[model samples]
Target: MDANQQVPSEAALLGLLQQFTLETERYVEAISNRHHLHRTDLNALAAMVAAAREGKTMTPGALRAALNLSSPATTALVDRLDRAGHLERRRSEKDRRQVHLEMTDSARATGSELFSPLAGAIAPVIDALSPEELHIVMTFMQGVIEATMTARKDAALAEPMRPLPGT
Candidate 1:
């Protein structure tokens, strides 16, 4: 513990963080229900929207890897999204065989409408933090998220594949 931090305080912080995660998951499930999307589809759309925000191209292969879907499944997803006017495919100039995916304007607008309210609601709380505190929070959150992602990856590699219950 730091000189200023007590053991009980640390434990309380951990408990609060865990609680926050559970609440956030519930919120995401609500959003998924509102849109009538399967959670996996929502996850894929989230990843695609994030890529769009960063001006990154998500190729079919990359999407497959990201979603852990088969080639045919990925193609089906791309086609479904295209039909919904949510995503579009582009061919590489250098290689006609290469296809990259990008979100349509409608998709971006819909995603923004759905997700921006949380950001708006949290702005005041985030703004209340001192600059240094905000920086530390951001840095710590990034590390924690990355650590969890790595742990999940490790578990996937080490464990036998299992289907969902009642599947």
Candidate 2:
């Protein structure tokens, strides 16, 4: 093996990882669309529902940060979900200016019903994994997530496009 040569193991692993991600995304998108929700809205709804389930509330600012959206965009998303009766925003009692988001009862039920089977479907595969294999898979997944996050941050920081000064 030459010092300059890359490891075949790494290349094979990366290819499988990429394929898994692409297929998973397509599957989620199909599920979301079938349920009459955009992928982003479904993601937001799931986040709000999970937070509520944990007895925690999320503010618009937090939601915006999590979803990587501007305040206005967050507000619009909240407005749409609220209008659809999927979520509700209430002014914080301590700080009336701050708005907290929560999923409606119907939304909670719907989300649970939709996700339960999906969880069940993956349970068998999870059960089949040995503890050590599960740990390795999770560690590799975390590395991939970190790498993707870093790439996104780096892209965000790239120099802005500008027309030639002479033109």
Best by TM-score: 1
Q: Lowest summed-lDDT stretch of 10 residues in model 1?
A: 35-44
Which portions of model 1 show Cα errors greater than 4 Å? 1-11, 53-55, 161-167
**What digit string (tens of lDDT, one per residue) describes model 2 on residues 1-167?**
99999778977987988898898888788777778877778879877766767888888888888788988988888888888798878899999998888788978877777778778988999999999999998998899899999998998899978989997
What would you estimate as the lDDT of candidate 1? 0.84
Q: Candidate 2 regions off by >4 Å?
A: 1-8, 49-56, 160-167
Candidate 2, position 127, lDDT: 92
lDDT (tens digit, per residue) of candidate 1 on 1-167: 68997668768977988999998788778886897656666667888867767887889898889899999998888887888788888899889999988888987787787778878989999999999999999999998889889998998889687888998
* TM-scores, all models, native as reference: 0.82, 0.78
Compared with the true structure, model 2 gives a TM-score of 0.78
